[model samples]
Target: MKKLTTGLASASLAALALGAITPGVAAASPAPSPSPTADAGRSAGPAAPIVSRIEKHGADRIALLGVAPWAEQVRMQFDGGGSVEPVTDGRYTFLIDKTHLGKTATLTSFAGGIEGESIDVALTLDEDAAPGIIPVMPRVLGVSKDSQGVFVIEGTVTYDPLQFDQLEVTASTGGMPIRSVPDVNGTFTLTIPAEFAGRQIGVQAHLGNKSSAVDTIDLLETRPNTASDTHPLAILSPWAGAELAEPAVTFSGVAIPNSQIVVTNDAETDQRFATLCETNVLANGKWTCDSPRLPDGEYSATVTEKPTWSSVTEQTEGSSFSIVHGDWKPAAPALPHLSSITDSGDHLIVRVVIPGASRASLEVGEHRDEQQGINGRFSFWVEKSLAGQTATVAGLVDQSVGKALDIPLTPIADTITPAPLTAPVIHHVADEGGHVYLEGTTGYAPFEFFTPGVIAKKDGKLIGSTELTYNGAFILRLDEEYVGDEIELFSTRNLELSTATELVVAETEKNSAPETFPLEVTSPADGATVPATSPTFTGEGIPGAKVRVEDTTAADKAPVLVCGADVLADGTWSCEAEKPLAHGEHTTTVTEAPFWVSAGTPTTTRGFTIGDADSDDEAPIVVTTPADGSTFLAGSDVTFTGTATPGADIALHLGYGLAPVIGTADAEGDWSVSRWLGNAPYTATVIQSKNGKQLSGAHTGPTITPAS
Candidate 1:
């Protein structure tokens, strides 16, 4: 009987163990049995005091707390949206959206277990003086290909519900701007217009009068593949509209299990003959196949699922694909050499000598066009705006780079409208037999002057005369044998009599060549500061002679050729640097090497500096609006606010490869930036800049967690 009693007690204790406390929650003590007098009224029980509390979190968020048992079936109604959940510690937590400050909130608790009265609580939210909406700028994450053949732009918008009514994203492809509204998450994904293909596009986000910085992307050189809706098998790798970096690529997709998968570029032909990959589908219905190294071209693939047992054969339509050699390296070739540069008053004439080139083109400032040349020789006419600028001439054969040349322009006088000449002057005179070849300068502009005439006489007696072209150039044939006398050459333009230029022939030497001088720089006056990266380097050199320019700034550094050129017939040469030079002092040496033997070295040392036009290099200061380390919903928007130097611009970079959003600070140095991030642990950074230069370091904010 004693053992039976003990067994009964053991079983009773086992039954009591079922009411144990849950993890992370405090165990509640059982209420003592009511006294006999207190339970006198059998149908009635004493009332328990209502327990409730309220906590303010931020300008827009509030927390409501209460006892767990009583909080069950409790409802709190306020503004915007709110949620309630029970915590393990016998407490109920309610996240209330306090959109209207100073407004009363009602919390009603239902009767507990049908024995208690329903309780109602009222409370007013604390007043907030801060501005309702932050002025943070919007930003873009980046650009990518959507399922469609077009591009999709993604970004975020952080704004105040009380201030702005809407946020819009816009895209421009040289036509009417396309606009879109961000979803509830403050994130937007917009599809570009079909007409945007082969065009440079610009995207931006707008909120009323405020606009985000324009983000530009180039799609002019690429062709994205559009997916076919009929294909049952979806190609996973080398996704449609994907720009690949390699030619040899692998394709992956999903199809029916145990069925044969055949990938081919040709839809009309049997895939088995020109199959890129042919294999039995895996148990999981996934398959992957690699193709041979493909040349840079467009490709398509289709799959055929062969039947087994009672299964029927199925074939998928062709899918779009392309092979672009974005990383292909080409063989290096010799560069085209600049031969000469001449200043022709209003325009600069540059000549280049390219070798082994079948075609060539000249690029002068914003103008680029193909030009014809005989024997690899090309000449380009540069406008006045190109003064002190670099001109490039590219030689091509089979659409491949054969050679390239760069020349500089430095005119002696300002660009002026040609004025009629007061008089024509005779300059060069050469006598062959009784004929005299002459070249001269004229004040008359092109296409304005008539043909010129020249008369020759010895001792005031008419000997011979000839008429010449209107270009102020002539050759007088004096057939008379007026030996041992001073012969005068008189030039007349349109019957306007001009003074005679005397020419005496005394013992003319046969087979005599004109003298030539070495290379020398004349314009830009030595030690003058020029405001250009490719400043024109001008000087005198032997006519039609080649010269090489080498920058010898530092002895320890290797010599860099800034430019190369040929001397013009007028003994002047100009060449622009092949590339811009860095800031600091530079000493360039120009050497004349017409025949690559016994060349002349006449070097010039000049000091110049290049300044950045965009930035001041000052670091910007950034602050997070929600004060970092905050938590939010998975698709909720997160706003960040910070301070920087007044008039500085701020940008917020969200994690997960998203494009950055940009905002400008007001005069008070206050700024706010916002973005809706994905559900994950994210640490963001704020960048500040004045103009285009960075003013501050990457001011990073605390990490934030977004829950589902």
Candidate 2:
């Protein structure tokens, strides 16, 4: 293809926040540390996911602008809905679809291979609910100059996308921006003035703050058919001129596969090529034909190809050949091998070694080649443009006998020096209208070296990009509309982006948390048994969290399938086993999935038998304080106590719909939680588990009744 594999560095805004590859460093260079530090055993783990954008209804496109730092995986669980895990490249943004208004999404990140904190995000319907547009990058397919001298460029964007509304064209040689409207299929065509011929031009699609990678094309007055894979028409055998031994002349050559060749005798006598000589085109494009006996001395023929496809038909002049009946033909020379191809920036040095030939010639594209004596070696200098094309080396051992070999060419980049490193900083400010600013110190010096670029993003949206360290300092300005906006500031030296620092804005400033839907440990009574197959677990969690079942009987406490359940409207939930369980005593735990930050992270565990319960494994739960059927006086500090399986977590529930007071059972199966009950007499229920973070179970000590 005529198009080269190149990247649009400045314009690929969507591609900047991706992957872990460090920029500017070669395989032998020192490894640079990540901006927020490496992804090793970090105790702080991944940062909580921020709500980047939330579209109300249309697509319900939910997004978080920046990826969670150090997150290997991220999961989202909507209260009463299933979870969507790892939906992004952990870069620019994380995305999911749903009309999640008034509902919360629990975002949990795992970093350094450890489960981190889960943050709840709920977006309100407002102008800020929608975020910046999705980025569309256009790729140039082909470029050519029309007969009218105008350059025609064609390209495509990823989706028949609305995101690609405008095509922006810029020329490096100076010119105003050229714009074009792209069709619905994400395809666009535009023309550049003839003056741009021989100059490099860059084209990309734009949508607000986002743009695709630029496709730079070097314009040629008349585009050669360089995109075609069909090799240019040529004669590869009996090469050009070969004296024949017998008068029954025969000719062979190569051309576009399956073509019809016509050879005309150029002699003044009748122009027939001795018999209607029409050769069959081989799959490999080789063809041969035999001519009737001829009393020939020296002669030339015009060879023409009539293509079966749309390719142009052209005539080629065959080098003159003579017919010598006494067998004066020489043996064909062997193929040639390349000794070295060196790059001198503007041109290349090609050295070849051919055996069994005293003289040879080399041709690279349209370069003029000269015949040179070959003591098994010959050298040629060719244009730098031929770096990715092919070169041919031919040897002539005798009259009418020769062979040619093709070798590919490649370019080399030898002198590469990187720019010095610069550290960047971002300052956090509360929401208020004013001239906001950030300034920092840098140790970077400018000695004519290419400096690292700095891009500032607010809520995962590009805000500004600036050239840093001209003389070791840089400045950027922002209006008040971005006050209280979260932005990440970092320096990008090579290909990799290290998240430098962030200006955090608390969502609570604009959004209030949804009412804390009650969480209850209310099902699968502790020590209850059921069939080994289709085991069922049930519970109730604060709105916006799913329930999960875990096999707590095991040493490591493995998950029971992906066993999960959406919460029922009435503050209850039920989940079924994904697979069959073993017919033995087991301790199962159920807990709200994607642990939340606030209160109500309720969990419960139950020991039950699939076939027969092991009496020793079953631990009965007991509530010893605020005695059963008893009530504490209103406005009194009450201490409740319970006992269950050793090391089990405890949740003491007061009937006033408040968050559970949590405690843990010790080795002796003892647990207690003290709470100040205010203004109302209340009953209490105790729910115990094999572990605290387990699932919901039926409340024990069902009543401790007393009137206010």
Candidate 3:
């Protein structure tokens, strides 16, 4: 940004000085340096050429250059290309292929064959109509005026239209330019007053940090578009190419008000058809719906919008999104707008457009109300007298709070008497993993919440708070110390919300009931014979407990672990046997041991026979490939080969919770299925009927770990 001593240009600076080109070097002083550092003892040579403007002509650049001695016959030479004699005004044109963009090019002026200093300029196509910068002018397609004296100018963008922020239209003679956002579909429309009619209007497109050349069009009046307040269905949230960590998604977008919007994803066709929600568009012209859970992969949702009084429906494909494990979904910024205000007698119902927000807050004066799990449209109720006041709106989505927006509220109408408050009632209660979970509903306003709202108080001491959502559902978790203590639950700190409800903690922390079946086998019921010795074992037990089923058939035989699984939060567990058990009568014992305890409780002894060894059976089913302890690399095909009874259909489950890959045994009693494996570990299980079913199915080894 150094400034050169202002010296007169060689009458060539008008064409040599560049302006407003993007990704540009800061504009240096147009005059040549007057420093006497070079050739001090003799006549200093001619100064290097200065580039003032660069015009794009197809793939070539017309550089308006400046030289020190305009009258001298100077040969202008460009680096990596041949030179051309510059006109008396110093205009140098050269072919700059697409490859030359962003590359540095040198220019030197030769005065009487003595080369002067050389200057370098970075080649760039980014141009603006502003002085010193060139451009690719926009094209104006049509112009018209409506009956209301509004002038409309429409145009077609030849380049990437979706990336352009705005297009400016102005009367070329004299007037302020009107700016309008260009549609992503390569078209734009701008409206101005009748003052600019019959004038040649210029159009310029502006992108981030760059602008296009000014293109002009004769603004002759024509027929105006007759459409009312209407817009195409557009999906604004979960924008193009978005990736999400969670499976469930909430699709939202803008459409014409009252337009019926049906949204469907490209997953589970049957469910997609049956679960489509109609008329998702709210009164604010924003539509949204909670989507069903999707599996990990790339997916797309399409919206079909059907307007009232129209039999035709238009469908638009939304952007693709990926459901990836552990990937974070950043919250989109919400522009909360005051959608509507209704007089509901007792209160003023104010609905705001808080798109993509889970929690919304409406603040007027000093009072504020917040709603959690907000959907497409969130409404806030306030006193009728508070209408016409400005309110600040905010939303929280994806754990990100959006910028607060202030919007003016409309005047409210009539009002009525307020209802009396009632105590909140608890409906369901349970104890799991030492914590009390309670679901309840309150008779007070659902949107109201305080710092210690819905509190659990022990002996008048503030303890905990829970929120009652818009659906009238509230859950509270208490510590083990409150298992038997009597606690009072109140709706708000002011005591105006609801009366206190007194209750005692029914159960917590322990599930040591001896009469209940603490541990039992759910699958392969106790006495029923199983076709496969390596069968999957699943059962329910107390939360936080670990269950292990071990074979103790022999009096002095070492116990063999048939299956082991930790109880889930919901008291369910399942695991498979990596090693096949020998086919014979076997007695097993179930042990339930909570993680916090040292000893495991022994349940009833269970006996089950495998394969009915006494009956003459067919060929034994055995897994041949994926030997025990075999390792696989990512993307490798994991092929499972096993022997099954001839002519029998086989179903093989490669890992837990996975659907079985079905195959048939060949005439020679061989069956195999191959699937691509990711970087993970898996233990397999194969199943068949017990009639002609062999009793063993496994790799007969340890679990296979795929290399990371």
CA lDDT of 361 in candidate 2? 65
Each prediction's TM-score versus the true structure: 0.22, 0.22, 0.28
Order the candidate numbers by lDDT, best to worst: 3, 2, 1
Put the candidates in TM-score order, highest first: 3, 1, 2
> Worst lDDT window (10 residues) for model 2?
1-10
lDDT at 25, model 2 = 17
In candidate 3, where is summed lDDT lowest over 10 consecutive residues? 1-10
lDDT of 3 by residue, 154-196 (tens): 5534322111122333334465567765332234567767776
lDDT string for model 2 (463-579, tens) is 544311122223333434566677776565433344456665322221111133344544445665554455545455433245556677876743443255433222344445655
lDDT for model 1 comes to 0.45
Poorly placed runs, candidate 1 (over 4 Å): 1-275, 280-292, 295-619, 628-635, 677-681, 704-708
Per-residue CA lDDT of model 1 for 207-264, tens digit only, reads 6565767767665324222111111355556667655534656676654434467777
Q: Cα lDDT for residue 511, model 2?
A: 13
Candidate 2 Cα lDDT to native: 0.47
Against the reference, the lDDT scores of all candidates come to 0.45, 0.47, 0.50
